[model samples]
Target: MMNTDDVVIHVKEMLERASRPITEECCIYRVPLLIRQLNQEAYTPKIVSIGPYHHNSLHLQNMERHKVMYLKSFLERTNTSMESWIHYIASKEPLIRHCYSDALQFTPNKLVEIISVDSGFILELFWTSNYGTDDMYLSLPWFATTIFCDLLLLENQLPFFVLHDLFCLSVANFGNNDIPPFILLTFGYFQSLNESICLLIQCHHDLRSLTNFYLCGENKTTHGEEPMATNSSVNKWSEAGIKFAITKAMNTGKDVDILVRDGIMENLLGDSDAAAERTKRLCRNIVLSDFQF
Candidate 1:
């Protein structure tokens, strides 16, 4: 019904209105609806919420006091004041808000408070995991298993840069150049889960994305290898006279890679139920990503 010139002008207007500056790196994302629909629970946090998306959720409210306690302990240990942390996060409020897919409904003060507490809690948790003494919370069975699982959920994340910044600040306050990087602390905390999987965390935005990258083998090319194609099942490979043997030489704690040579398959599996479940979850998340795109 419209002439070509009229259509061209209309499209130009639409493009101008839609265009905006890409200032924020997408650090937080809503799990694609298609993916969430497939296995909603997989992407949902069960025991804790790390960032604004799930902040103030009723089921997660129980952990709020624990967050405050951790924050207090962190401040005491490092001799850094909370007001300074609040000011730093407040200055970056806009950029931090832009990290999330949805608009944050909290006022500036509330938003800054949320980010400060959450970030501090994460830093403190990692510190305690690596260096604290006889914290009863860490002794709880649920803390080692379920809490670790929640921390890795797609909906449960703080921007990695925020965590990195806070961790650096804390270490500096302690005047400790000997402190290890966040990645090492993270890997140490979760080494019991799956060591191979922890290696994926360095490059991805969040835990869920890291797991997806590992399952998809997206970084294999970095080592001059092609991305792994969907390989035949363990049973199917065995049928072809490929003898599978657990190898301690490559004990990474998860059979994430397969090396087949001379009718033998060296299976480097970790000795943890948590590692096996993590692999299964990675496979599920990959299928969800497939459905999403």
Candidate 2:
């Protein structure tokens, strides 16, 4: 008979081969085992190693402090009683295990990178003590969902629109596609206005003229009522490009409103000066002042 571990490995291999583009759900437990197998040499060190613990003491302490700050903010903002949040945590403990297991599939360094980015946003937004009971209290499960969604985007498995919809639903209802979805989510709650505005401006930079918003028929085509064209154009900015523009703007302390009014993003998004002016006029006239989503 085959060894049990061998059998399990074979089974996982079969399952993986059967599936096209393994999903988050598919790689949940299998990834950790694969990592262990792949890193047997590194992991087989002296069982009672002391260097990592001693050397990384300060780093670990900093991380713990950061987690505490994030938890504090989340509890305060959601007005969740400490006990209630703890209870919710207990309820969703299994899911957390799955997430960690999923994370372990990648190399430790890759895992750290993802966690750092995801947790940084959480800490930045939620690391505070002042929160109201009336505010929406997202549970750890919801937060995990956000993390997974972000991971999908980072991997390019899902598009921005998917994440945009999820954000809208979590924060507010998404209505018709009149105004941009980011704008709707931002304006829905006043407390989040600053963060929302930042995301909206980032999204505006990401937009490539809404290629899907096209008119149908040739001669007497209806304007603005047509579906998106089958083919869409993209004007994606490199990560370095985004960083440079944002850094320059932040250093100048310029208002984003002025940035748009002064036509800064036009060059950044690869629009000619003339195209930028015409597009701005089109946006002013065609965009609904009170469009919801």
Candidate 3:
């Protein structure tokens, strides 16, 4: 029997060879089979054939509503548990479509649609159970897929989605070292997109601590601290933070558009355009000199 290292190496190698938009058959179905082959301690294969097309066909047929005679017999024969069934179904390539569809089945309209609820979709799509912990393994993939969908479906109002995507990336990197390499690369790709949502949010308003934001979201903003956007000290802190983030983007060869308007930047610098200009020019000179500032 192969060891844990062998299993890991084999999985990594398979992942490397696979192209973008990975297949459910290969990743979800085949990968598990491969792992089970390598290590018996891994999960058991309860059921198979959870591909997108098959699931979509089931949805179109309205099998859930009618509770068909054959379908009952099929379930009884399979003896599949609900949780395991859902997990297996979600491991497929067309998993996102199924997830979104299943989510909408109990919704008001019983139809799949996005972007009609203003920016409320961001909150709904990426809900957190608690404020303190940052275990986002489940949230990340959904966030990424939603952002990609928004880019396609909400082209006109793409800024909000992009900003939300950036927020996810920032929060993911904020307090975690267990992020997968593909997730990191995906974060980098979204950041590089010229009109970044994160920059817009950072520039338009300052970023409060995650805990503080959570509190504010819950209407428990009783901790007397100045607003991120208007407070002078907060503005300065935010500017420095934005500069650092932008600098990091530049170093990584990502295209970054500064979101702070010139007038606002000047206002933040105590109505001193000269000082702000001087600082920017100095930064430019430092860049030209090839010296790390």
Name the TM-score of candidate 1: 0.69
> What would the per-residue lDDT of candidate 1 be over residues 1-293, giving only the tens digit for each residue?
75999889999999988734443466677787766776667778877788888887898899898888888888888888887788788888887777777767899889888888888787788787888646697559767577888887777887777777777776788777788988777666666555334245543365444444322222233544553234434444335554443222222233334433322333344443344444455455343222110
Off by over 4 Å in 2: 1-21, 24-64, 73-83, 86-293
Clashing pairs in 1: 254-270
The positional error of residue 41 in candidate 1, measured at the CA in angstroms, is: 1.7
Tell how far residue 280 is off in model 3, in angstroms.
Answer: 28
What TM-score, over all chains together, does every model reach?
0.69, 0.27, 0.17
Off by over 4 Å in 3: 1-87, 90-103, 106-180, 193-293
Please give the lDDT score for candidate 1.
Answer: 0.65
Q: For model 2, how does the per-residue alpha-carbon lDDT over 1-293 read when each residue is reduced to its tens digit?
A: 75899889999999887733334432122223444454333223211111111112342243345345554554443343545434433443333323322233444443333333323223223222122223233334455344323222211111223224333433332244553444343233223223312222333211111111221222332455663331121121122222112211221213233344444442333434444343333233233232211
Best by TM-score: 1
Ranking by lDDT: 1, 2, 3
Indicate the TM-score of model 3.
0.17
Task: Write one digit per residue (lDDT tens) for candidate 3, span 128-193.
Answer: 211121435324666444333332220112122222433343344346565333223323444323
Worst 10 residues of 2 by lDDT: 46-55
